[model samples]
Target: MYKLSIKKIIRLAAVTLITCSLFSCMSDKSEQSKSFSVQITDKPLTFCNPITLDFGTDRARRAGEAVVAIHQDDYYLFITGLRGYWYSGNMRDWTYVDAPDIPGGCPSVASDGERLIVSGDKSRRDVYASADPKSGVWEKVGYYDREYGDADMFIDDDGRYYMYWGWSQILPFQVVELDPDNGFKEKGKPVTLFFGDYKSHGFERRRPEDVIFSIFSYRDYLPEENPWIEGPWMVKHNGKYYLQYAAIGLELSTYSHGIYVADNPMGPFKYSPHNPLTFKTTGFMVGAGHGSTFHDKNGQLWTIVMIPSFYGGRGSGELALFPTAVDAEGVMHSNTEFGDYPQYYPGIKENAVANNFTGWMLLSNKKYVEVSSTLEGYGPEKAVDEYFLTHWCAATGDPGEYMKVDLGKICDIYAVQVNFDRHDAKLEMGRGFRMPPSLSQYQSYTVEVSGDNENWSMLIDKSNNTVDNRHDYTELAKPVKARYVKLTNVFTHDEGKFAVKDFRIFGNPDVAKFTKVKDIMVVRDPDDPCKAKLLWQPVDGADGYVVRYGIQPDKLYNDYLVYDDYTLDIHSLNRDQEYYFEVEAFDSGTDYFHEKTRQTMGIGAEIELFRDREMLARKMIVEGKNEYVFENIIPGTYQLRHTFGPNMWVGDLTKEQLIGSDNQVTLSEKISDLGVGTKVLGQLNIKVIPGKENGKFVVTLNYDKP
Candidate 1:
């Protein structure tokens, strides 16, 4: 019989301290598959769902217009999230520069060839300057008399300082001359540069919760005619000036940004026909606006923008980076099309961003997995589904817990990104977590691959790694062919339960042909507010269908694969918001599911997102006495189900041993697992001799779905 050391289970238990406080904390495309110009990175950039901007101690999720500045020709990324600055020599690795005096949110900092000027959104336009911004050394230099809106300080080539600011629908993104010596005080009257045209420019219009009315009608405080035109940032490319600015309310999924160009830094700016260059129309994480553009060490142009998060603070939560380029015609274009996906960065001195793509599709996504332990919602699939928010945690906090996958075929493997899910707060609170030693980590692992299912080779060894890169991407210097890959835990960083979100394996399969999906459309179900219908023009020669959907187009966390139908009901979505989905028609049917392509990933089964909200079932052993008492079940009809099997032993329990059941319970034969999705609930106490060997069990309870 199983017993609880802690008699009172912590239901709705607060997420561990890590989840609350650790709010803290990409790619190459190329080749003849090179038909696609975008490149993938060794480290595919995933979405910042629960962004990693949580400061050292203040776990608040808030930030203003993100700023990317080059101080004295050095690349720096600064955000007012908790009012701290991050410095980077190579745009990839960043180090935090301590600046405890900087106020939170809506702060702007800029360099004037020699000095870095900093200002905030407070009533008084007090400014601070630093000769050495790299080290966070600043002293209040001067003050301006007027209280300004969200603004950007600019210094033209000829020692002239200017300020551009405004966000009122009636006002324009105004520009004014400033006196550099006196905190960039206004020297001339502000002139209207551009205005919001909500009527003509649909992106600038404020959406009234009417799109998904039923789900978002609770936003009753929305004011009409409140379109915004603010956050002015300027860039000088070639002989022309590009005036960039953000618009619309932050609440809209379509909140975006656009630009205007002119020959001189000041007058007659022409709006680019390609306005609203940066936007995120659909996804779990929406809106990318109010950002700045700058050059990296390589002089490669990059834009940093604000991305809204359901879990973030006011205005928005996290910042996303998108590489920008000026076309032959000199139109500056910010490539945010695949903004949330993994992207390759510009090399230290390449003329442009070189996408280094290893032609390998996701090889281990949704395939069968075997782990040392799993319980309740922390199922094994959580590690494969690519949802970092969920996880597969070991039942006990023990070392040597491992998860393995059988690829069915010996394939060429190149790279793997190991995303260890930090923590899953049973209780939603906040975050501040330092990885404890008891709940240590895999100090080292003898990552092995095998072809005969018996013989193995050490692919990569981390058996004594002192540094814990919780999210690690190991790009193999040489590709290896293997059918099975196993991550053996040699050690752990802590003594707590071990968990992981996904192990994204990259490798090529045998030759295959895949027909691209055409006319794929996602629309809300006419009869259901919570469901969306994805209809597509079926390809003539196709194996099956695969659909990936997420709030952010870059991170489609939810996926589905259908072998027989052209339609799918997306049952998992927040009614109040829109979602982004991309569909594909594959040539290999479910029979060849093991051979997944870049556009198509295996859809074994996506545990219902709602399941996480429901009461989880207890897991029992294959052969042993099992007693499970779900207290306060609240008197409801329930069904018994299993993860691996409703094994023969289940029938032996008999009627008396089954708790909370009155009628005779019949035992049914089970053939496959993952076929029985949800709506199965129950409580039982059974005993079986140690003879059965083909079953694994983890059960969950929930009300029947309509």
Candidate 2:
């Protein structure tokens, strides 16, 4: 499981005390110039999925199953996706700490209030022990030979330690009793715990493609029908043991933790009617399968699961928190459908109710971007795109760096999320072998809201903040009505290279209702099977529509928000895999009185193709290089479908091109260069005709797209 938590209970209850005065926009002007803030990690490493694991140093690290154990004093030790461990006062954000043990593959650790036991996935030969993991000094326990496909240790209330393990297409996941004193010796035979019937379990099927991995140590597998049920984790509540195992791979968009409930510590377990207790297949991101669950200081159930992320063709996933609950029927569920959408954070549930959304919509999503300065190709609009994978960065590393948004009008402001980003910070942090990961840099800034461009007041201040919160969601003590807001960074920890992933503001405005239209489904694009088309019945009172889709459920940052029809065409989809999408019908006043504009919108606006917005075409990312291979070509008119925008170019395919079967084709920069017909969208829509082999060709591009 991927969730980790260690906490010391603090009982300071109650927050909405009428002690402070409720403030309002009194002196600010009606129209003013202000700025907005977005939220982003300091540095992120993009993998096949790109967000496998995040190291503290602003460097994104790819990771697998992780564990969390209690540490001395109320601290929690986050065993990383890699070899080291991270420390956190709160389970949300963490700091890095190094250990002497070898790191590779999935590792597991467990704590029994006082001491801890651990194991790594490599070899699966031995276990380790430590009285104080905070010190990072652990002694070897013992070696074992029989087997442990994957190791996850669990300590019962009575002090008994049980180890669950497995991961394979052919083998079943299992669990066995262990002797904690003797390096967790096998006290009993390992029993097969889960071999779900994928025939009836739709969620257990493997991804549409093979386990085509390149980022991790393990890669390449022929995909079949049955799925890989790995990462066994057991948690007991009310005498019922819940056996959770991760199912499917890149299918996290539809992946889940097949849940099985047992009467005794051992078998005779039955599938929970609520199987896949933690399952979410739609939204910005894809998967919520392999992760860990824990109780917070207040004893509320919470699970941290890996976020399914795909960029290029490889699946590099990340982790996020999923608020959980066990109903009266004793069923557990991970509230993940709106997992990536803006919602009240989990830690504050103690002071607020489970549902704390104020119905405030994203006020500046995709708003025009204004900046003090910008880096090459990093447009201002990126700061407001709402996609976590993209960001808007300043050109120079200097103080006073800022990004501003007009917001189109004055509105009541409620909250702001500042997404900080790290781009090539490793070049400056001095990379070394097997070093612990942590963020050493910090930002200290002041946000001033204004009504007029000239007049301003401090709305929020963090100049003296000693804490580092990655997703800094700041809510005013009370709603502050304002028109303009400006964020000025007076200081930074490292070189002041100002960066932000998004500047999102939530507010109460003349908002349109989201027409949760029915009849939702996805099919391969009829014209281009490589793409997808999402068609739904138009809402009776709706004016237009917005379609949001992506490889992951939580990171559905890619969108076609301006469509005004029932059917939406998505050309930017990853061809090798399936995707998740959401459709919303809106009556954004503009379509209300303007009859002519409304007449021209909707199905009539369907695009023939979405111009390439990708900085790079989808490819397979290896340890050191990204590979792009185009397979199966039919003889016909052909064009390299990619960005025709400025300063963008693709690698030459003439040399790296590979032909197989009856495939054949030529590489040229333009139609004139190919000595063929006229160019369309900057390149030739050349007639492929037919090849001597048949009527197809394949092209492979190496290095970066020009």
Candidate 3:
């Protein structure tokens, strides 16, 4: 007979108790059936990160330094190297329009309650304006005689215009007032605002863990660690001016944004306590810098930043968006925890504190995958590992090459994001160049779903697409129940291989929510304030945990995702700052809760050590921090059985004090013959460490298990 683990039985009892107590009854059939009815009522309005944009006809498929402007209830998106811009009425669907009059690289846009003014990076001095941006008509309205790197234009409440521009390792950010009445000419000399403080701020340093140093800084000419303070943006909130800029370097994953507040649009400014207003260095999408912020039609604030992808070449990337806000205490910050996951657009959920994350966990991360073919070092598993640096590439860009994901069970699939990476593509144009719209290549594919791995149904069909969509996102018209999802390649752009960085699936499993994570421990290094260690007790039914931390407990804006681990070491923190942390456990599509439905050995049942239904070793239940060593065994599948009794705990209580109950819960589905599949190459040790929970223990299975 198949035996269930003691931990699994206890969790089932806990869920049963909670459910019965909530309803105040257990025998009524109507009450029991109503409890399991669908909890979701509405189709969530959500968007995933690396915000899908019209990547244009660029050979490199890269964009960065994004800026967003709103005019006449419409949103305009401008990015580096694109010949034109994109406009969206609801921020979900964007339409691209060519701007022949405006030059491309690092463009910025600002609206003056009427016409929209646009400008480009350092070398492009000619400025353009459009009364109707959607119509694709722009006129050269102004020009700056002097070159300004990463320039941004701001129009204050009093109709005063100010221009902020600077991008240097040895220069501070500068701002000068512009006279809008006089062809947008400069009205005053540019004032040096501030420079990056790498010594005091560890996040401003140049490397992944903030360990590298640049040549020099503006204050001290001597060789020292320095950072380029670029991409200056301005926003006025409650009579306070918030000047934000990207720091470090664009190539590093730690590239982030910091904020400074002032009373005037161009004046003395102080760094906010929350130094890096936006930071996302640890998730599937990294780098939240060099972006623009704007208010939606519902008055909610949002920021769109650049996420790096240097595969095409250096300085290559896509864009991402996050919900941003300033608290009542005037603290400016952005919520980046699960920033790359599915999130509701503005006004869907009014509470900014809770964030807009749809709670649809990533279903395909590290799950079993099967592909039609693979190139060397580009395995199928890489496509679902939740990291952008790795991908799965088929041997050729053939029409029938496909990638499939096994969700392990039937799940409520809500959305799917397919991130196609450029692998061995024909280089039609180099960096900083745009291809003619007619020459732009298109990607065509079809997404299908299956339940029993044989019969399939179409989910998302883009086989006849004409647009250049690299990071394509599809929110299903209706959520479907599926066990397998497959993406078949109909066409690939530029004769590139069928490569995918991530085939992310979003959904919920048919299981109860995971219990809260407890016994969290944080140890900040006194010798090096930039580093810290976090440890927490593992929670049952959790596929992973998100560590949320920040300067204030109520303002834990930054977060990191840790999978299948109880401990983490963080190195991206400010040296001279204090932070508070909290961890939350989340359930994904691959959780082991499905085992609860499987039939198992009775309570207090002991298994005669078995191998393929044959006795092999003595019978005993290992408990506490004890070691168990089995004698020499053959290379075969072994069933590691466990049993539990009512009120049977594993903690500090003595065996005599434990009370046994008479309940015998029988599950319906029979458990499969699965166990520690291993070869007897060497001695393998399994350890059980008692956890703080009443009847739970941490099991460590050792072997060549990835």
Candidate 2 global TM-score: 0.59
Model 2, 490-537: lDDT tens per residue?
Answer: 555445466776676666634646565557777776544445667787
What is the C-alpha lDDT profile of model 1 across 161-231, one tens digit per residue? Answer: 88877767687777888897766678878787778765445456665551221124455644565577877
Q: How do the predictions measure up, each by TM-score?
A: 0.60, 0.59, 0.74
lDDT of 3 at 265: 83
- How many residue pairs clash in all the candidates, one count each? 49, 44, 0
Query: Which one is best on lDDT?
Result: 3
Model 3 lDDT tens row, 1-706: 0000010000000000001111111121110111222222344356677765544343335668988877887777788876677777666556677666777878878899889898875787888888887777888888885787898999888888889987988899999998776777898788989988877776777653432222334543334646678898998877889998998766668878888999988789998866777777766777878888776666556777876764542346667877776666877767776678777665454533243666666788777777888898998878987778888999999898999888888889988889887788774324455454444446789999999989999998888766566677776777899999999999987778888989988888355254446678899888888778999988876777777677865566566777758898876677877898777777774743221211143211333334565655543422211223344333343455453323111123222222223222211122222232342211223322222221111222222321
Q: Choose the strongest candidate by TM-score.
A: 3
Evaluated at residue 559, the lDDT of candidate 1 is 43
